[model samples]
Target: MANIVSYLAREQRTFEEEPFNMVDGLVMATLAYLRYERYDRLPARPSEPFRLHDVLALASWRDLLAGSWMRDAADSRSFLRALMASRRYRDAFVSFYVSESSDAVEKQFSAITLTVGDGCVYLAFRGTDGSLAGWKEDFNLCFMDVTPSQQAAVAYVSGVASALPGRIVLTGHSKGGNLAQYAALCVASDVYGRITRVCNYDGPSFLGDPSPRVGDPTYRAMLFKAVPESSLFGMILEDGSDYHVVQSSAMLIFQHEPFSWLVSDGDFLYRDGLTRTALWADGTLDGWLKTRTPEQRAQFIDTIYDFVAASGVKTAADLHRNFGSIVMSVASSTAKLDPETRAFILDTFKALVGVVGRETAKSIDPRTRIRLPRRRESYDGSRPADFARSLRPAADGSQLAEAGKPSHAEPDGLQLAGAGGPCPAKADGVHPAKADDLRLGECGASLPVPCPSAPSPEASPAACGGVLDKD
Candidate 1:
């Protein structure tokens, strides 16, 4: 009966056409969470196969895309209305990975809410896939690889540019920003002229020293980058896009959801406290394993792969939940670990959680102690770590950044970091407070600023060659 219910929910929600939106995001998030929570309670052996959550999540996500979320003029009030309208956002996101193709195996993913504002659509696929399969996967609201995803994104926006008969705007979460930039690059001469700007929220680092040009030059000309003060994921990318660094209350750095910026009725204003801890445990775990004898790192990765392979869960959500449980056991020191391996296991687990907790904090409600909005006077865009580092902690544990730092004017506004790669765009211009900016951190905030703008790749500073900085 439970299986039937799950099947029906997934089937009823499948996306077969266009017009996706936040309703899809809600469904995907729901399925991902549900499948993650229950993967372990099912059969543990392949022969006795446990139900897969990936398929279900994918189905729900696709269904959301079939709606009209991607149309233009979409706003936060409408987005939230859509989210609240659904009962299962997490599940839909989790189940988005049930691909039957061999080609899409290696790619990062996201839901793209185009400027058209139909709502939203999950754009998932690997960058490595060739053009044929790539073209088939509805570049509009489907998964894709890095290269192909960029291509499709460009086409979508170029179409918008052509159709609008004027300038077009593009933005996305995570890899979506990368795609947006790629689209800007790919836009045709006439179409490119119509694109106004691009915004990327903490997307991954762009690959290549002589960065590969994927979209139109005009498109690249109008790109911007935004991230949380203590960003983890987006910081890995380069410093080319227009940048903005958001202040957040959620601890564990990455949790800075731009949407959380506090807003009052019409004005997006905020007042909250934010803090950062090294997540020392997170810092050393994986890298330590990698640093171990090369053979040890290889062995560690293999061991984890084997463990998951043996766990019977077959979907993305299932894998996440199962791996999470396994990690939790490692963190709690509750698993029956070997005498020689226990210390390593716990250390790795702690590090993993701290890192994920920081990133996940922006959207997921992992229990947190503090939350703050960016002070209008404090809107000088310094990195959060820099912000925290500048100030001493009060006895009450509040951070005191640059005393009498009477808020300087927000620089050309935007973007962070150390520990990872070179922290991009330190202080770019930040506009008036945004309503969404007050509630969500950078990753989710929708500031009412000019569309994104970017520096030329040829002009972008080279990756400090071979030295990936830490967060």
Candidate 2:
């Protein structure tokens, strides 16, 4: 299926010919918000708004493409360049009031406003940037009533609303989406009245109690939510707002990329509902989160952030570049944790793994039952490779067949057996299964490789491109 880039290339109609839709708003919001990072070099907000065409004319598209943010800054720039050349969006957006803040102790907030078409203003909030502070605020959403960025968004929206003359449309991707919803709800009655729509493009939901105004029927009606079928970030703490599940070309968590979302004739390809895998993940995560006390949740967040901060990497890009050294630093820091804290961390992780394993095992065919060898009674906090080695049978004892080796046959199919099982080798001498196919644990149930981190809500496939098939 074609995505936004291909959609833009195919459609040549202007706003007058075809009015703006959610997809159009989303593309504009993405471009307007992510490009603010480039404006850091500017002295301040210009007295007059700069049309996208004019901005691209004066600025170096090459240099803008070089600076990285958490999201797809390069692709967003590309889309802007494409939009500037197109009849559809060439004169549609004029950007103004770009600002960004970074406070290690509080949180990070960044936003920009664009006047789209003729009379409507779109306030686009930048989602979590590469800044560690920005990500920390994302975690804070679980506990806090209002994140620092949310507060800033409220103020920004109110101030901008006073100065602008036209109706408003608030929109954002990822954390920016959350901020857009929050700002729209918190704006004064007059400003709120002027809001045409509040579009949340796979933004997270509020966990704790939100403002009473958020529940107002009229306000809720103004909100529009959409998520990809295999969403993770969008499902977190999400409820109330009816969310549209859209088909995405990117796999698994990478579906968070707006560019991966399939577009047809200037609109997204809507799905019936979330994928079964997404539903299972949401249920599993919600259950796990409930098991943790508020204090435990806080501790876990703090501990993880502490480890990340110790590496002295301020941005995700920096961490990506020096991943090896950062990982080593994290390992060293992990070793310094008190025994009790260490135990708590390990036990929590173990429980989470057990949940995933059990859930995965349920999905396998019962007739093809494959049993794993029993695990040892105790587990030290050693490396995974060391633990695997320790599980190996004694030299004199019966040995488990290697991963690809055929061990035994059941009535239904080949069953992997424990030590002393027959090792029937194929003519090629290679095992039937590859190492990657072998699942860890006592049930021999397969599971997808755990993602290193939650995909950025607003990340573009072009920014961090890869594919992982769903299990």
Q: Which candidate's lDDT is highest?
A: 2
TM-score of each: 0.38, 0.73
lDDT of 1: 0.35
Tens digit per residue, CA lDDT, model 1, 314-346? 434454557777565434443555856766655
The ten-residue window of minimal lDDT in model 1 covers: 459-468
Off by over 4 Å in 2: 37-43, 66-78, 93-95, 361-471
lDDT of 1 at 167: 31
lDDT of each: 0.35, 0.64
Instruction: Report backbone clashes per prediction.
Output: 120, 3
Clashing pairs in 2: 404-431, 404-432, 405-431
How far does residue 80 in candidate 1 sit from its true spot (Å)?
4.0
- Count clashing pairs, candidate 2: 3
- Candidate 2 lDDT over 1-471, as tens digits, reads 687777777777865466557787677557644453464445344424556666666666655544334234335655765766777767754544555656556577766766545455678887776677888889877555566677778877776665665567788888888888888766667777667678888889776434566667766666778999998888887653488999998889888878788888778899988875776576556656666765677787788788888778787788789999887887688788999998888777777786665444433333342446445523456656655654554343433333333433333322454545432322221112111221111111121221222121322211111121111
Ten-residue segment with the worst summed lDDT in candidate 2?
Answer: 462-471
